[model samples]
Target: MTVFILVAGAFTGPHVWRDTAARLAEEGAEVRFAALTGLGGRPGGPGETIDLETHVEDVVAVIDAVTADSGGEIVLVGHDYGIHPVLGAADRRARSIARIVHLDAGMPRDGVPALAAVPDPRLRVEVAERAAGELPPPARDAWPRWGSTAGLSEAALDGLTALAAPQPLGTLLQPLRLTGAVAAVPVTGVLCTGNGPGVEMLQMMVEVGDPALRALADARVAFFELPTGHWPMLSCPAALAETLIEAASGGGRRLTAADASRPPAHLRPFLLDVPERARERAGNTDLYLPDGPGPHPAVVFVHGGPVPAGARPTPRDWPTLTGYARHVAGQGAVGVTLDHRLHALTDYEFAAGDVADAVERVRADPRVDADRVALWFFSGGGPIAADWLTGPPAWLRCLAANYPVLAPLPAWGLADTRFHPVRAVSRAGRLPIVLVRAERESAEIAATVEEFLTEAARHRADVEVIDVPDGRHGFETLDPTDGAREAVHRAVGAVLARLKG
Candidate 1:
């Protein structure tokens, strides 16, 4: 007999699992709903008293009773804020659990509080400062603030608001500590596609060489995708229950880690064989100077990534960036490349500061024409274009994106306005923007480019598009066809013309 324990997230209790738990039981599985303290009909005992530990004990008590009677391991499921306590309990009873399910939830790291779960960094800080001990759930109309309301009906949302409880500040503020014991446990991730990134997107990032994301390739980790939103239990209980059953049975899609021996796409040789020019390093930026007697226009290439913090041959060293810089220099313009702290999605603001700083340093150089400069972004570096779109400077002649990700993906984090080029493009006014689109681009990325184009059109933003129908993302090294080569040539020429004009 399979045993399953369901733990609901913040502002919710076991009640939210009623339909799903019934479905599990009907399938001949013993289902237990872990009623958290201060939630699920439990009273909020005191200010800040019902923290992560309080909820952990609540879950552990259920586990102890079930295992004592059956003398067998059970599948443990955690959703949203509930995952925090579920993990805390799982760590203590690692041997008692068969599989741990991450249901539309972020992987909580050790020492990080659930506060990081808030998505938008700026709003997270504000929420932290205003909370004394407990956090009241948002109003009925505001329930969408916490999670997407995609499939929820008006009546369902009404019930959600009515049954919600005050989430204790401690539950989010307290740090989660792990013993490394849980790593040995088999895992299943139920990715809700409508709410955020699905497994496909994660695998794409992994293929690009993010060491931090390599854990997804673990053989013990399996995945299932739901065509719903964050609260899958409430939105599509039947489908979610079925997925949960499959997850408990250790049946789901498994990802293969890319071969370690081969170099990542970025490190591969440049597609075009351009003569190498001497490089000069000033702080985090690298300069490829043309053989000219006077100062020349500059094109700064911003490489994409939330690359692993320790990645070697940094962006500045990547063959892709170096190739572009050298090609730009060969065209009689200075090619500037820089390393930024975009080690994670949250570091965009920090990386933007690095990009801004590098521009200053490059502009100050005697070899560069400070008044004529263009910025080109690649891959994940695309959103940084927002900063220049709004009130572009006189010296900022052009902005270009190559297979750029113009928006934040679902479930990765909050949709911070800081990096959304689609919303900020209206302010771009008459500033020239060049877009290099890939027909075989990832769905998530292509969607963002489409969104930016739609918004730019509505606002009449001055924009030009160059299509690479035969190319994929990172086409330079990945696609060696003539189409990819010509697209690259055209994109560079357009940006160069803007700088020279």
Candidate 2:
């Protein structure tokens, strides 16, 4: 019914789409694979002056030829670096394309080269260094290292590697030029969740109206996730093909501006008016306020890692932390998440002070029940909240921690605080605590958590321990399993129950 044009990423050719195209063809669709200039076994070698514009010409030529032959609408799909040329072509021929699919690829804006989208500074530098010449493909034997071999048979790997070729450096170095017309075509993103953090960060950028991802802001674009590696065609071809068919059929869910502005279905976003001084030091605080009225019990989320110096915190920056905040909000409490300075080894006390200030700001909010507040700490944030747990305020209802560091990390210069959580829990005085321990926790963190729990029990401190046998430290948001979800649900329920009483 529709013509499907597939474009492979750099260093690969049309052969990369062999399995997917075959499956789609069997499903009764017209499929054509577009081998970009200088890619695949094309006559020209990598040194051939093949730039982004040349690739765009290649895709546009295919669109013209396919449309002229069939007179049917076209679905243009681009993977990885292929996205740049496909997007450029779509912008040039917006009326001819029905839908555009970005498969685990970077979405570049006008005037930005594809290389600018690379997130790692070192990788960016490496690319720049190689910009003068052809960028060689990974060795055929190292397919596994490149993620192409995951879930694929040896024969499939051999076939893929044989088809690989050196990519022209010009394609990545050249900037993409667009007149904004491409937004007219419906866009669908089939994201690979194995790179969870990166995808989450992109979603956040879209949410906050970051101009870099403005193309996705168009109402025509939607996103779907596949729980596989970057090369989904090899890892989960069936699922990828099915998603593509759905997108082509206009049956996929759309991502709208309203969806981006609010928290997920379970929670709502709120802006807290922190002291101007606190805002100056730690940016702003985003609160995921639960549904319902009248002063609800609340929890202040202290996220791990002071972000790198000069790196500002965005809602999408720490997916795991933000996800837990939403979960806590879903369970009938206002979940407050803030951004504080990344602490140097000697700056733990200063960081703690900033967190305390955030807590005070949250308590002052009229929507929060100031009398029933709890502190939930994660990773490096654990030591920052130790003071509150040690001698909690009378209004503080409970404390919930997940794979937290109860003792100082001497390596980080986090030591000799007035009250260590392990030593202070004994005198915490009836303050209830819920600790969720990840089975795959680091040895040091596990040992510290063990000692803290032991001391709590010996002192008769009111505490509950929930073990997530299948979870890693950041399981709640990071590699979530059914067990992790259930563990988090129960943990939040416990904290809420205590606050309610």
* Predicted structure with the largest lDDT when compared to the true one: 1
CA displacement after TM-score superposition, residue 216 of candidate 2 (Å): 3.9
Q: What lDDT would candidate 2 get against the real structure?
A: 0.72
Clashes of 2: 1
**In candidate 2, what are the lDDT values of residues 1-501, reduced to their tens digit?**
788999998688887777788888888889887878778535565446878898999999999999889977799999878889999999999999999998877667899998765543344577788736677776766443333233566666677777788777888899999999997788888866553223343443344344445566566777777766567787677788888888898765454453645553112321211111111123557777777785988888776553444433443245565666666677677777777654443456677877888888888888899999988887656766568767789989988888887875322223335536887787788899899898977544666688898999899989899988767655654444677767877887888899898
lDDT of 2 at 426: 74
RMSD (Cα, Å) of candidate 1? 3.3
Per-model TM-score versus the true fold: 0.87, 0.59
Off by over 4 Å in 2: 45-47, 140-150, 153-155, 197-218, 259-301, 304-338, 341-501
lDDT of 1 at 440: 82
Best by TM-score: 1
Supply every candidate's count of residue pairs whose N, Cα or C atoms clash at under 3 angstroms: 3, 1
